[model samples]
Target: MSKEENAIIARKLSKRFPRKVFPRLEYFDVLRDVSFSIKKGERVALIGSNGSGKTTLLKTMATIYLPDSGDLLINGYDVYKHAEKIASHTTLISPALDFQKKLTLRQTLRFFHSIQAPYGELDIALDFLKRMHMEYLLDKRLESFSEGQKAITRIAIGMMKNPDIFFLDEITTGLDVNRKEDLVDFLKENISSEQTIVMVDHDPLIVERICDSYILLSRGVVVKQGRAKDIGKELAYKYEVMVIMKDRPEFDEIVMLFPDQADDVLIDGHVVYFRAEDEDELYSIIERLRLNRETITKYVVSLVDLSNIYHALKPETINEIRTVEDEKGLPERTPTFDELQEIIRLFGIMIDTKSGVKIPPRKLP
Candidate 1:
């Protein structure tokens, strides 16, 4: 497809933040020369481990964050130059979006609806809430509602704008079963064919069901890309065979036996995992182990899932994702997106914190 056919494009985009290294200041790169594109109306999933910059990349694409280097174009317009216009066309839903706990759901919806939509649009937003079965809780204080109720409320408020592009950052994580069903029903019925959705979700089942393609990120870089069914081939069959053995010898043997399907086979120390795409494939793998059960300590045939992908993307040497608890003095990384927004609200001014300098506003086209 041509460049004009794409909804969003990132070319060698890079972003970094300043960090204190005891005696001096150092820079930590969050995004490193990232490049990717999403066609208009396509549903795409951002897959990655912790601290892989998935959230940061999503924020950049939504124009909530800007690239320090390279170009990001949304609908053929430079995001850095037309940030506001691009952002207005997209709505991001995540756990970071919080409502006032003291207010009733009715009051909260009206308050944000007045800001994001016209008077008549309130009914449309209410319709979504009703579909989610959250209208009954409208008079209840937000603080008393369950996390699942809060989840749907966020989407309802976000949809008030009727954005063209939806950017979801792990929106389904904390939802209860009933609420999750409601959200799924909403996605299936409410979303239009022409609207685009970019999401960051850990559940491979949801990703495969909702997304057409996926971009896998690792340490702030695109490590892999493929069709959604390639999520360990979960669409064909839902079984995984994990054989416990020793050394690369078994790993090599399995690879040799299943040369064509080697990509579905993976080994990490004492465990060898086989991602079966079908029942025949699942039994074949188990049958192979049965033939050599004397040498095989044991093997298990369970449901195929996203664990292999996560293991593949696991950092080779990284210890762990640092958090606020990791810092004894100042934060290890820059303030989070919510923190920065709060700062801008209360302080009347905020800096990027990368260079400790105020950023000039971008001019609208």
Candidate 2:
């Protein structure tokens, strides 16, 4: 590819932080020799566990943190050498940073437009706000807004910049179902063939819907990288398989194949588990089971669902989960979108319980 077509390039990039104590403890290397390239118009997801260095890599790319070694270039400009010029075309949006709580929504957006484009494209900013359903909150101070509202506002402001490259860090953390769907639709509509977006998220559904490619990070290293579909397929192959049963087969067969790894599968109202060396082996067993089809009720590959993936990658938060469950008991009536909201809330609480990282509760105006 031509040099200009390469929107982002990092070669052996690394970052380290020194100890804060007086004795000067060991230097903690958050990122170690990480490198990757993102082409123009490509949407890529960065997936990893917490403390895997996804945020550190993004900060370095955004020029918020300088790499201790190696080089990072964005649109032909070295991120370290041309931080100001790069900022003109690059925007970073994350819950942890990028918004002014004291400013009213409209005022903060106007200020961002003035600083980024200077000519004050107020019309464009207002248009975007209206599109995001934030016009009603335009006059309210950001501090008074809910977490979901703030997240949506940040997205709208980022869109106003019409950045050539956008970096998103856990941007979907607190959004409700409707708002989340709206933001996803907005991303689909606005992300053009000329812009590059790098997203860091634990949400596989988001990755499945929006990302063209994915890079799996573990301990600050890229363990796998490929098209999003391919990654999903590979994960399915590695983790799940179709099963056929005849006359309500004994549970031992299922348990023996999967052993400890079969928690994801359910069959005939009973949890089933199995494991094979690979996809081929798993399929082979299925084929044999299907030959006797007299007793098979249903068969489908049981892959790791998004929630399972999230929990697998992150440490479990037992206390937070119990607290959320305790507060929001199982609904006695038919479940609705409101119930889904409560579930997501409980999920976040569970994460907090284990990690001690609180995900601020979201509210509505």
Candidate 3:
């Protein structure tokens, strides 16, 4: 409701990466004038397609990637001016941790923990690692660990920080069913309501377990954001009916049949997806397709999921972002490889984990 009540405030935030594509270096814009405010203590899911800038926005907000222009305020601190401060309070756990270094798991965890909490207790963190059944790998080199082991170790290290803001990027990647469920349950029970969690997870279980709200991104733009239940209302639908046809000969005919629901029809090869606002609508669509069973393969119907939301979003142009940057007199220059490395090193050096309590924090009452 107010500035003080917000945990993150991003205004006109934009970021781009220089890609060495064949003949010349091409500038690819990842985030374009993205603006949104996340309320304090909200467990919000950042939903978007593969290349929709979800990770970029999360890293930028956590002060990992410096924005070329625009302002980002997290927990009342200007990210640019307070990048070091923000890094201390925020912990970003990403797949980048999937390294095959020669160091053992124990050595890696100790190194990171000492960087943040030199006097903290490692036994507490180890106890939680035991819960994930990864304690046996403590002495094993990272090179010998499986993808799942590396992923679990990363989670253990990141959680050791006990940051005020936890940023999870594809957290469910490489995790097994039992361990994934255990980690989610432990976090849901331990993380206090005052501590914010911003995650990008595709697994329905994670979203259903923790996410109360979401921010949907489409091609580097803030397309939609609100409470989780509000997404269905935005699309004017409750359930999704995906009809798999042997051949899409009836695709155009189906579209013509429901001209009023033209926008709701999303065609992917032989699969035609339909939005049903209610049971009656869902029933009608299903029956109509059954008449053409000779041309149909099968059908699938379920509640609206994040992937469905991403597909339904219309992409926007980046010309407006370019025009705004030109008006602001922002110069377009790519940071050198060395400069980028130095920037990251500075981020590492500036992080102050001294304020954190012991790892594997006690459950808050």
Candidate 4:
């Protein structure tokens, strides 16, 4: 309700990049009227496919890039007008950040600490380095560190700041399973409700464990924003089970058992492929057929998750989910495969023929 109550607020935020194609300049939309607010102390995740503007949005919020047009407020202060003030309360940990490669781990911490107090505290940094099992490499130059080591180092530096709000952009890029687990443990122990965090991470397990909410972006727009658990349950809970039976095994009877849960049933050769909305539903089907376990030659269940949701969601449906209605409107819906082909033919971009794809007239010799 109040500025102090909100950690970040964006209104009609849009970003564009000019790309030159041949003789024409086309403005590529990176973020289009994307608007959302983060309550103070909320740990929210920003997720989407590659090139979905997650990084751009994070950079904009961190004051690294000014928006083409729109108002972006950080901790109740306008990002552009009060960048210096905001910097005091916010810290961003991203791979895009530049560092002196020649600087040793300890030196890097000292350099960043000079700019932001408490971030380079000797005691804190040393403690974190020890916990990361990296104290032994304190003298190692950044250029000599492995990618995972570099990630851990950057995270250590970020944790030292203990800012009011933290922005993370793909900080888990190079972490191994153990390192990732350690990072998650550290975040859980350190991040409290008194501090806010906006992280651009794709690992669903990590996200679900740390974040209370999420913002789903598509084609540079906020497609959905809600409780992380709820969204995950709604879109990521299903599982696909493929079973091979000694005989056909009554395909019609399996559907009867799961009247509502089982769907997309198909007998491809001898493999029966279908989907169950949840584990319980899948179990229900299994129980009904338990008496004939020997008849089931083989079976496989594939869990669906945020990745599945990303692939299944149409662009229009994504826009509708977030209900984005502002001056900067939704993108034009994508054309179907057939419709796209027709358009290409009309514009001579290329032509699909029986034998092969024909080159555009402009490229024809």
The numbered model that scores best in lDDT is 3
Kindly indicate the candidate among 2 and 3 with the higher TM-score: 3
Task: Give the candidate order by descending TM-score.
Answer: 4, 3, 2, 1
**What 10-residue stretch in candidate 4 is worst by lDDT?**
356-365
Clashing pairs in 1: none
Clash totals, every prediction: 0, 5, 0, 0
What overall lDDT goes with each candidate model?
0.69, 0.65, 0.71, 0.70
How well does each candidate superpose onto the true structure, as a TM-score? Answer: 0.68, 0.69, 0.70, 0.71
Question: Which candidate leads the pack in TM-score?
Answer: 4
Quick one: ranking by lDDT, best first?
3, 4, 1, 2
Candidate 1 Cα outliers beyond 4 Å, as residue runs: 21-25, 118-120, 229-273, 276-281, 286-308, 311-365
| Candidate scoring better on lDDT of 3 and 4 | 3
Cα miss at 49, model 4 (Å)?
Answer: 1.2
Q: Write the per-residue lDDT of candidate 2 for residues 1-365, one digit (tens) a residue.
A: 77888999888787887746567665656676677888999898887777778898888888899999888899999877899988888888888875778889878987888787753356655766676678998899999998888787777777778888999988888888777777788788867889899998777777667788866565565544556444334333344443455444454555455444343333433323343447776676577446545555565565433332333343332112221122335212222334434653665432223222222211111
Given candidate 2, what's the lDDT at residue 272?
Answer: 33
